[model samples]
Structure formats: structure tokens, C-alpha cells
Target chain A: MSEHLPQAVVALDVGGTAVKSLVVDRDGVLHRASTPTRASDGPEQSFAVVLQAVEAALAAVPPTHTAVGVGLAVPGTVDENRGVCVHSENLGWTDLPVRDLVAARTGLPVGFGHDVRAGGLAEWRLGAGRGAEDLAYLSVGTGIAAALVLGGRPVVAGGYVGEVGHGGTTDGDPCACGGRGCPETFASAAAIGRRYTRLTGTPVDGARGVLDRTLQGDRTAELVWAEAVDGLGVLVSDIVRVTGASRVVVGGGLVHAGDALLDPLREHVRRRLTVHRLPEIVPAVLGGTAGAWGSVLLGWRAAGRGDAATVERYAELHRARVTS
Target chain B: MSEHLPQAVVALDVGGTAVKSLVVDRDGVLHRASTPTRASDGPEQSFAVVLQAVEAALAAVPPTHTAVGVGLAVPGTVDENRGVCVHSENLGWTDLPVRDLVAARTGLPVGFGHDVRAGGLAEWRLGAGRGAEDLAYLSVGTGIAAALVLGGRPVVAGGYVGEVGHGGTTDGDPCACGGRGCPETFASAAAIGRRYTRLTGTPVDGARGVLDRTLQGDRTAELVWAEAVDGLGVLVSDIVRVTGASRVVVGGGLVHAGDALLDPLREHVRRRLTVHRLPEIVPAVLGGTAGAWGSVLLGWRAAGRGDAATVERYAELHRARVTS
Candidate 1:
């Protein structure tokens, strides 16, 4: 609907561990630059460091780039439409004017979005969920979160769709969200490690060590793994009942366990949901780069370059970048 | 719009114990007729009886109708678009070709819909949910069922909604649906009477006797009542979680217990949901007549009569019926 503007946008994906930045042109080509998050320094200092990374990424861009716009994907709840980080417990943030702050520092238009939901959008459009209309992407990293895409539009569900953290667990497990019984308290990668440590008084690195111990015939590790699977089953059952998703893409840090996690979680859900059709649970194809790719996609859409007509423009730009 | 048609559509609402027939003119004036369902006689005998009732209601019309279209509402799971009764445990139906059978018999276009969902549509458009866009209506009669109206469209949720009967209870309870613990196994009006009969070793007529006994400080009755309230609370909490509804309209036989049932159930849901916004739980405005009124509204919409635009047409039709 508007004239095509050949511009490169700055994309930032802020996770608990690191901040990933990319200078992406109208094409989906990424000139990547990443740095340690250092979230302990709080929002002010970390934001300054993020600005430096963004500036460095933008400075690398060619002279053809004009009017820099930034797309940010941040972990935790976001008032996305307003470009504010409402509350990101992992980042020690409360009502931070992130987009405004970034804009003030970089003097660029910013688009803000929830990290998992933005990743889900990328998965739905170009990754695992490509050509699929109705889908739910469950990213099970430090915590379990979901993004439901229906009719190509995500059902905000009053912003409760991905708050799977507060969904009740079988037993009363403590959650940081103040809920005594939540799926996240039992099934998250953090929960797996916590449970294993609590059971055997052996502090493991994360879910990977817990799984390793279980496979090595550690009885306590086996019990913790079983409970984690059961917690996941409840979440999967509830999602199937409410969202009617035909396909679910599962991703995140915990998925590193791979078939060990997938096999049992799938079996448990199949056993519980006897009445309805079960959706296929598959690993995410986009992997670690999903959020950054999603941020770039968001920027492309924001720049009015997301539609049937623009696919050719995208292809041409992508080809030119590859040839160059 | 096209020129106003003088034709009247026949609306049949078939419940477990009753069959209600209405000759609703284009404006939705119901000339009502009814009879016992006699469902134990089986679908064949009962369907024949329904046809006769429809014919009689048609004969009672002041003016012989033009091209007739019939809208029939039935209890249980249905393929609404296909006009097939996929299954009705109450009606002893399985994969019944209801639309084709009725259409063949009546020689008219037939529209079939799930009774609860159709009733919810009626309520959302012309009853309790008249102005509200997003609403969830729970009907608790012989069983407990729910209907979600979102943006004026009743969500079927893969045809699993309105099956609140299967929602498991907090405490284990016997349910006829072959589940160990189900909401309807304790909270339904049928459950109240059954619980009373089991406790006293005497046949209590219905929910009213149990309510009366509870008022009289009968320990058995009080326990039963509390369990029912708790069961209902779990169902409502799950509904609130999935739909994010801020207002719930409850109807059916159990709701007649009034504040005794409503107050406690509301309090339980409020206490359970700490994180999500609590919805207002209120009695349905449609009362016992919701089904019949909803049938009329369904016929009205099916006949291309708009609620806001058909005030004069509705008045004229009402006057015509009154004089005739």
C-alpha cells in the first residue's frame, strides 16, 4: 500500500543470559553482534550496554540504509502495543519505558514484542509452522510460555494465552508468580534442576544433568523427570481443550533433552486426552535464532514489507545479499 | 436487503423430557406448542412424534406459510455445519443424520444446532448477554454445560465446549460419564437429589428437597450442598482461565437454589483465582424460557431478521397472533 523503502532495521532480542543484535536490511540477512546481558546491573546500566551494541550494529550498515527502525523482543510480559516492559522479573524491570528509552538513545523508531510470542510468529510464518493456519508454539526454556496463532492473528486472550506459568500443577509446587501450584513450578528447566537437587541433595547444572542422572538409573532423578512429564501433560491437555490446535511446536532450553522429553510428554498427554484429537508435538526448527529472526520479521512488517507482493521484493533482496 | 418475506419458519427445540414447537413468523413471534419427549421410545418413534408436533404447530399458523425453513435445536455433540447429531447420550443417538431425515420428511431446508450453544446465541443476542460481546453461559439442568459467545459468535472449541460435565472435581467423586471425578457428578441438580437419596436412604424428589433440608440444618444435606458448590467453583475457575470472561451468566434447574448456590460458588471461584481478573457471576435473565426464546431468536436470525431493525415487524406479528 505504500512506496517501498530500502532500509536496514536494528533488531535486538534480550534474554536472561544475553542480548542479541542484528543489522537486518529489507532482506532477512543478519549481521550479528551479541553481548552478555549482565542483568544484575539493573535496567539502567544494562540498557546503556544494549544501546552500545545497537549503535555498533547500525554503524556497520552500508550507506544505502536510511531511517533506522528497531525491533525488540524481550523476555517476560510486555505491554507490546505501548512499547513498555510491564514486568520482566528476570530483568528486574517494572513498567520500564524500554522503547522510549531506546529511541531516546538511538533516535530510531522501535517496535516492542514479547519474546516467545515474537518467536512463535516467526515459527508460524517461516519456520516449523509454515503453511499451517492454527498453531500453538510452546517455548519451554527457564519457564513454559505459549503463543497461539489462529487465522494468522494471535488470540491475545486478554494477554493470558502464554501465562502458562500460573496454570495449576498436580501437587502444590511453589512458583515465583505467587501461585502455590503452577506448571512452571514443576516442569520448567529450572524446576527440573530444583526438583533433582531437592530430591537427592545434589545440585545439578540444569535440566540436562537431571535427565543424565535419570538415564544413569538414579531413582530420585527418575521421579523428578516423571513429575515434570506429568506437569507438561496437564498443560498439553488444557491447550488442546481450549485452543483446538492441530499442531504444536515445542522449543526452548529444556528441549535439549530431545526425545527423552518428547516421548514421555507426548505419551502422557495421549493417555490423558482420551476423548479428543491429539495434536502433533514437534521440536522447533528455528532453534536459538528464532527470536532474532522474529524481530527482523516484525521490523519488516512494521515497515510495510510483509504481504504477498513483498515476497518477490524479499526474494530479490535476499538474492542480492547472497550474491554480494 | 431483499424485500421482506411473509414466510414463517418452524423452530423445534428437543430436550430430554420435552419437545417444544414454535411457528415463528419472519418477525419472531412464537405460537408455541409442546409435548413430552418420550426419548426412551428411541429416536425413530420420538422423531416421528416430533414431526407430528411440527405439523400441528404449522397447521395452527394464521396464514399458511411460504417456503418453510426449519431450525431444530438438540442436546449433546453436533456437527452443526453438517446438520448431523454426532452423538447424544441422553437421546441415545450416535451419528444420526437428523437434518437429512427431517428435511426429507418436511420437504424444507433444515438447520440443526447444539441446544446449549443455540440457547447461548439467543441469550447473547436477546437475553442476559444482549449488549455484552464476550460472554460464557453455563446451563446446569439434568447436566452442566457451558457456551462461550465471543464477538457475537458462539465458540464450539472443536465441539468440546458445553461439556463442563466432564470437567474433573477437586475432590474425587463418582461420575456417570465413566470419569472418577467430574463437576456434574457433584454440582448438577440431579447430583443434589441423588446425594440426598443416598445419604438418607430415602427418595428425595429433586434439588429443592435437598436445599430445604440444608436450610433445616441437616448435616447430610449441608455436606452435599457444599460439595456441589465446590464442584461448580472448579468448573467456573477453569472456564474463567480459558475464556478470560469477566461476566458469567448461569442458568438451568440448579440455579433456582438462588443465592444459596450462587453466593457460595462465586466466593469459591473468587478465592481460587488469585492471579486472573475475577468475573461477575450472575443468574441468567432468560430463566426457564431461555430455550424457547433462544429458538425464536435462532429462527429470526435464520430468516434474515435483524434484532435492532425488526422491532416494528416483531410488534406487528405479535398483534396479528394476539388478534387471531
Candidate 2:
């Protein structure tokens, strides 16, 4: 507990196919490692793999660093207050007491939360959404989802608040969620690739390939890309109107398309709004590391040092690290 | 300042056509009055009418009652923190310093807020949404709007959070707000009547007439009514997925149809949801007076007596009054 000791924490961001683990110091420096989640191994085996990843990160922490706690961000429905993974469709977990198990195994206090929500927190505090009190982080990746930060706190809502992907944006498109016309059915990165392939009866790498084909004036790719952008516009416009978010930070794989995605999407959303305060739509700067950084912040809060000053100091360090 | 004195507040609910004024005691017992807003008289004149209504409510307060504060709820965009009415298209007001003006005129502390938000607060605290930490009040009136109560507090995002009416639901239907395919263009009470009339080249009273005609097996009426219900279903389903509200209280004119509106809406939204929490949709119990009661609660908060116990006592009184 010496004041001179450099504070560090074990942070893990567990996704469906991969787990990212990091030893994050208070200076916002990251020592990183990763492991395949092996979700197909089933819940118990995947849980064991998660623990191994955490142990590896813990082992990497230098002896000079003081390890205070562990922070975990997992995908799917979560009850953060109760520290339970309520249900994760991809991970095959149901009502797992993840926090208690992690605490018991690591003998460290655990701060558990939803991955997207934690990512939103990181972006809100230190990335593109910084300085905005009301913001939304929309991740358009394998599947579309959003994380809402309102009044400076991430809205958990029993881990169900950010399912905008399930909202209807079309008339009859079939969705994997067993619903029709869902935004995710047409707007997600997976959807763009799948739709283009289905229309042309040709294999494509993913949304990236679809975008490249569209750039080369491929009719089917252009149509698919246009539909995805339109669906995204409808969804984001609805979100802005409902939440009064002053800004929306777009992230995930599709964002790599840069202005090709942003410029048209912004114009479409702008045209949809009539009386709402126009939100500044921008790109997320933290890229794929938002969840890990957010875990560090969560660990700091768990250790009782997550005041405004501490957060600002860490944010400055993060900025310096990224820029350098 | 006497501990033995009963505290009361003057509360006003201002709309485009009329203003409701009342003297509300700490127990939520209300002595009410009304005045025509005459907004066509222009902003200054309407503002004068508003002041006159406040004075009338203050005059109605019993001499033994201690009027410590005032609460005013008005339609359109408001900045509650700055106590300014940013704009009210119906009232023809912009950048009006409503709170300071009321405070100066009445020598009382003032709580100013958006009408829909205040109404939502009342419903969440004392009406159908009672006991739900996350709830939404959807008002399907002349023009549709909503009020969101999240985590037991009204979300006031500079008076813009609940503009779901302006969100698109169809491909192209002109809206007064300059947007196309807005929910209000299809689902609002006015829309039902106007669309029915436009389709049949016949005039109808309102949504009630449309419902009555449908019950009588009128084909055109059935078509219009069905469209309104479908539009409402889409909007509510989107809202449920985005906000994760456990319940939604349907209020305003359309709820008067009761089961006719609620039954089909419940079924439609249920069909649209997949892997998301299904919200309980119910009629708002406070009817049209929700806004007035909400203003009283705002006044209570402004007077520094808005603890949970105090709120509960007021809620009981409100329930008794409404039931009686």
C-alpha cells in the first residue's frame, strides 16, 4: 500500500472467439497477451481458458508494480451489480456467477461488466466521446450493438439497454435473432458480406471485400453497401432522437472504411432529424483496445481510486501513449 | 419558515391551446383552475397569459397555506438547468427565461421543465409505471411524444430525449416537422383522423371515430386504424430494445380506446422482439392530469422537500384524489 508503488491491474476483455488480456499500469501502459476463447469447447472449458488468460496477464505484471484488482468485460447480457453473466448466446453461458468465480480463483477483487458498455465508457472518458456528457458508442462489426453513456455513466439497464441491433429497420429481412427486418440483419458487417454473396452467388471475404467491390462499381456490392448504410442511418437517427446523445462514436471493423462509411451515414442521419439537436458523429479513436482500457478504469474503481483526478491523469497518459 | 405551517406550491401545465393551473399542497391535494393560452396572441401576450394563470393559481391558494415555490411545465424544447425555454413551436416562444421571470413575478423559487418529461415523472412515481425502475410513458395524442424514466429518474437531455414521434417508421409520409415517414404521421390521434379522411374523402371526428368505424366493419377505417397500430408497434418495439425499459405507460387520447389499442399493440411489439426483454405495455392511470401533478412534484423538489418518503405520501394522496 506504499504511495510510491506503481499501481497495476489485470484486465481481460472476453469475446466470443478470442480473449484479450492485459497488465495495465496506472500510467495507461499496456502489457498485452491474447488467447482463443474456444467457445465451441462449451461454457466450462471456455471459462477455464478465461482464467488462464487472466493468470498469464497477472504473471506478466512486474514485481515493482502493485496489483490491486482484476477487471473483466464479457459479451452478452450481464447483471453487473450482481456480478453475473446472465446469458451470452455466443459463449453458451447462462446465469454464471463470473465475478465471484474470478475473485475466488485470483484472490483479487473483480469488477465485471458488459464488453460493449465498458468500451463505451472508455471512449466516453478518454477517446472520441471525451468531454461529452451524453454520448453513444455504436459498434458495427460482426453484429451491430450500441453502448450508451448518459450523464457521464454507462447505462447498464440490467445489461439489456444496448440491443438496438434487434430493432426493425426493414420490412421482411430475416435475422439470426429469429426476428424479421432487424437492423443487424442488414446493417452489420456480417450482414453486408452475407447479403452481397447471396445476391451475386459469389463468395466475398467480408464487408471489406464488399466495400472494395462497390468501389470498383460492382452493382450487387454497391446495392448491398447502400442498404447497410441506409439501415445504419435509420438506426442511429432513432437512437439520437430517443437518447438525446450529443455525439455518436462509430467503431468496429466497418469503421476501417473511414469516410466511405462516415460521410454518407452522417448525411442520411442528418436528413432524418427535424427538431433534435444534431449530434456530432465521429470515429472511435481507441480502435480495438477500448474494452481493455475500460477494464483498467473499472479495476481502479474497484480499488477505490477512480476519482475524477485519477481518471483525468490516466486519460492524459493514454493520450500520450497512443500518440507516441 | 414556521415548522407548523403547511407548505404548498403553485403549479402550471402550459400547452398550445390551454394552460392548467393548480395549488398543490405537500400531500398532493390539488386546487385546480384553467385558462386559455391564446398562443395566437404572440409570444409576449402568451407569456402574459402564463403569468396571469400563475397569479390566478396563487390567488386560489388558501390563506392558511404557505406557497413556497412554483413549478411550470411547457411544451417543446427546454433547458431545465438554465431555466430557459429554448423553443416551443406551438407556443411561439424561443429563448424565453421562463424560470427567472416566474421567480421574479411571484417571489418564489421555480422549477421549469418540459411537459412530457414532467408527465412521465408523475406516471413513474404515482401511476401505472410505479415500482418500475426503468419505464417509458408514450403519449399518443394530437401529435405523439414520449417521456423516459430510467433508473427511477426522468431523463432530461436538454428536453430532447423523447422525440420518438419524429423517428421514421415508413418509406415516405410527409410530416409537419419536415421529416418523411415519422411515426406521428401514421400513429398520432390527429394522423388517424386525417389519414382516414384523406383516404375516404370523408371527415371523421378523431381516432375515436376511426375506431368506431372499424368496429362497424368499415374497410377504410380498418385500414387506417391498422396502419396506426402497426406504426405504434414499430416505435414501441424500437424503444423497448434501445432503452430496456421494463414497462411502458400509454397515455393521452388514444389510450381512451383501452383494450382496442393496448391488445393489438402488445401483440405487435411482442412479435417484433427477439432475445430482448419484453416490456409490459399498459394504459396510464392518471389520464390527462399527469402533467399537472408532475409540475407539483417538480415544485416539491424545488422547495427542497422531494425525498422518497415525501414523494410516497404525495403519491398516496394523488391516488386517493384520482380514485375519488
Candidate 3:
């Protein structure tokens, strides 16, 4: 019966290149808008772009619906409790009072957090990480990062908790990040394409193009793919051992490869583990909408509607809508 | 005033080879006892030996002091909430109702947990992990293992967490655990001695002997030590990335190598990390006594004397008394 209640939220997911804004309710996504984030223009300009995106989302709220609140997610180090963005190398922001700026401008409550963690929160609440007590969502995008949810709470650790891409592992090549053995050098979506092109002297589309070549029985493509799987195996093993993550939700662009990416990586981590519980390695079904969707959660909390029943109601509605 | 009270607890730290028992109060260690564990004789005999050790410890409690409770820490997978030993290959125990049996036998409230985690608790409370909110204590014993403490609480995860010894990483050789890339194959104290003896056809006095040979300009010792350092660097980098461990207390036998082990491992991890916060890599000051000392904390909890004030009093009394 309460499903008939008209309530909505405005949310913005601020990334390095783009800021995705969405208007959402329990029923589903109502409206969406996108804007370029001129991050290199530095904090003030980026701040202006974020505010513009928020305005666009606020405008998309249906007239019949009550605009509950707004949520904002941005890249790099963030302190959610204090509502301050500590640092963002991409956007050139430091100690930016993201929540205060948005709250002051909109005269409404604002929820703020790190983009990847926000994405992981969405998965934990409504998608692949459902029912997992300890879950890790690894986002293998243009830049690789991971997010951890332990005991059903995001392990924020001042937003530096999941930079797996920067760890100097053992087998991978030197990374542009100035690390000699980082897994991102071989496994991240951009790195997969970069390595394949460097090895074959041929430009491919992206990690997707390389996957296509592998299906066609390209030996070099298979080798490159194998290296990526191995790198993921090593990194995932570390995550499992230290965090006891019972479910690993593989998210981001490379997850588009589907079984081709997960199957071998799962097998590799399995063979490497001697006395550890095998976590279910599954694709994050929410795709690119996760961060924005998670912002919806943040919005409801800011609106004082963040009860378990409210979240569960959305879980029943959104999971059916998005996952399907 | 609390320091004048003569109250105590009996505690046991059961390892694969030996069972250490301690009778203690806030002031410091009062009584210590050790017994060989015939773990190969299976669960019944091992259980009998444990009971005998407990009896001995109870007897050692001074006549004037009241023994409040008992704490028992054991190896392998443990469910602390259930007080059950889930599995222990060394002791051939599975589904052993440890707390029930001990409590019924002694008529005392019993506290139970994993041994390595117990040691980590000791460190977090009174040793190198003193001020760290998120800490990892790596025990480089005959078999390498680690224990985690997050948010000032031990990450139990049904005792499957912190098996870094068994993770299939990228640098180390094949281990007896059937993993081709476990850090334990190289970085463990046992592994260090084994590798040194295998290369030079000379037996050493454990890992300590290999350190001595390295000081004497033995090239094989240096090579073996370098491999160990590299392996540890890779594992530690992953730990820092995944867990955001601000303090890593290196415990067990190899920590005796002091700066010889820590200096190179610290530098290696520093080179491997690019963007993460620099964690302090320090030796576990309590050394082999940590697990038994940690058992004291568990004992106090069982006795209804576990509180922040009680723990703080212990910290003030024990750190000064033990650390010196």
C-alpha cells in the first residue's frame, strides 16, 4: 500500500571525466542527465560543474513526487562523517566541503561519499553483494580500485582502503603509477588494451576488442588475457586472506567480458588457496548505474527515511527492476 | 587503589607443539607453566593434556587471590561465539566443544578463541599495536600466519581470516599446502632456515643461524634473505591495500632478526606502495608471550572484569612491567 506514496531523490555521481545525475524513487529511475567534469580546470570549476549536475537532477524530480533529499558521490579521498572531500588528484580538490556546499545551495540535506565505495554500497544493498556478510567489489575500470564491505558496513578507512591497483605485486610489469609490480599494469581494462597493443603492434578497441580477438584463437590475445586473470587471482587472494570476503562482486567495464574474465580468475584463486573458504566470484549485476543508485540510498538517509523497511522495499523493487 | 587488589585469572595458549599457561593480574605475570602437547596422539590425549595444564595453572594461583575465570586459546579454525574448535589438522580435532568441556570440568566460566588472534589481541592491547585502530600482526613462526584487529575488535570471520601464509601470491615457490605462490614458502622463519640449509649444504641454528651466515658474507644466505624480503614486501603491500592496516606488528621467531629483517622489508614495501598511507612496520615486542598474555584479556572478560577501564588499568600496569 505504501508503494503508492510518491517520493523521489536527486543524486550525482562525480567521476573524473563525467558527472552522472539521476532522479530516482522506489519504483525505478525516473530521469537521468550527464555532464562533462572539467576536472583539470581545478576545484572551483569542478565544484561549479557538480552543482550544475545537481541542479539538473533536482529539476528532473517529478512534480507529483516529494523531493526527499540529495546525494553526491565523487572520486578520491573523502571523509563522509565530516562531509568533507579530503583530496582528489583528478579534480584538484582538497578539504572541499561537498556536503555543505550542496546543502547550502539546495537548502536540503546532502549525503556525500567516495564514488567507488558508493558503487559498492549499491551492490551490497540491492545486487550481487546481497546476503554477504563480508563482500569485496573490485572495480576494474580505466583505473582499477576495489571497495570493501565488512560486517555489512563499508570499510572507508579515510577512503584509502581499496587502492589494490597501486600495490606492487610480483608478476606484473612496471606501472605508469611508478610501481614496478602493480596488477593494474596487466589486468585493468585500460591496461589489458595497452598490453595487447604493445605486444601485437596493433591497436584494439579496448579490453573488449582484445576479448574478441581471444575468441578467434589469437595466441597473443590469450596470453594477455591469461596475464590479466593471473594478476586478478593474486590480488583477489590477498583480499580474501586478509578480509575473509565471502563474496567478490566484480564490477566496472571489464566485467563486460563476462565468463571469459571471471571463470579463469576464479579457478586461479581457487588453486592458489590451500586452507581458505572459497568466495563466490560473481559479476556485479548493477553495471554502471550502481554509484548513482547508491546515491539514492544516501538521499533517503539524509531525508530521515533510511529505515530497514524502506531499504528493503527498494531492494524488492530496484533489484527486480535493475537486475532484470 | 585498584592496583592494590590481588585478583587473577588462569590462561592457556595451546600451540601445535606446546601449551603455555599463565596466572596473571593487572600488575604483571605471576606464574608461568609449559607442557608438551602430544597433538599427534589425537584429540582425546590432547584434550587430557590441556586439562592437566589448566589444573597446574589453577594450582599456581596464590591462595590469597581469587581466580576469577579461565581463557583458552587454540590453533586452527575457531568459532569464538560458539566456543567450538571447528577444525585443527595439527590436533586432529573437529567440532570439539572446547568451552563446554573445559567449563564443565573446571566449573569456571571459560573464554575461547584462535591462538594467533589471541596473540594479536595482546599486541593491540599492550605491545606494538598499542595505539592502532586497524592493526595486522604477522606471526612468522614454523608456519606463517597473521591476525587482524579492526575498529579495536578482532576480525574473527569464524577464524578463516588472516591466513596470509596460504594465499597464492605471485613470487614465492610451491608450498606443501599445494599452492604455487604462498609467501610462507619464502618469508616464514622455518622457510628461511630450510632454504639456507638446502643451498649451502649446511645446517643453521634456525633462521637465526642464517642471519649469522649472512653477516659472515655468505652469498647464498644473502640471496635467500633477499627472496624472503621480497616475498614479505609483496604480501604486506597487499595487506595494507586491502585492510588499511596503519600498524603491522611483526611477531614470532624471525622478528628476532630485528633491523636485519625489518629494515630491508620496510624499504621493499615502501618501494612497492605508490599512493597508500605509510604504515609503521614494527617488531612485536611481546614476542612469543603474546598469545598467553592475550588469554589474560579473555579471562578477564569471562570474569565480568572486562571493560575499558579494566583494560586501561592493565595497559598501564602490564606495558610498563612487560615491555621492559
Candidate achieving the largest DockQ:
2
DockQ of each: 0.23, 0.66, 0.59
Model 1 agreement with the true structure over B126-176: per-residue lDDT tens digits: 556666545778888888888876444566544555466663322366466
Q: Which candidate comes out best when scored by lDDT?
A: 2
Could you tell me the lDDT of residue A159 within candidate 3? 61
Candidate 1's TM-score? 0.81
Worst 10 residues of 3 chain A by lDDT: A167-176
Model 2 Cα lDDT, one tens digit per residue, A211-272: 99989999989999998998889888888888898899998778989999999999889888
> Better model by TM-score, 2 or 3?
2
lDDT of each: 0.72, 0.86, 0.85
Model 1: number of clashes? 0
Candidate order by decreasing TM-score = 2, 3, 1
Fraction of the reference Cα-Cα interface contacts (below 8 Å) that each candidate reproduces: 0.07, 0.63, 0.63
Winning candidate number (TM-score): 2
**Distance (Å) between predicted and true CA of B195, model 2?**
1.4
lDDT of 3: 0.85
The per-candidate count of clashes, in order, stands at 0, 0, 0
Alpha-carbon runs more than 4 Å astray in model 3: A1-7, A170-174, B1-7, B169-174
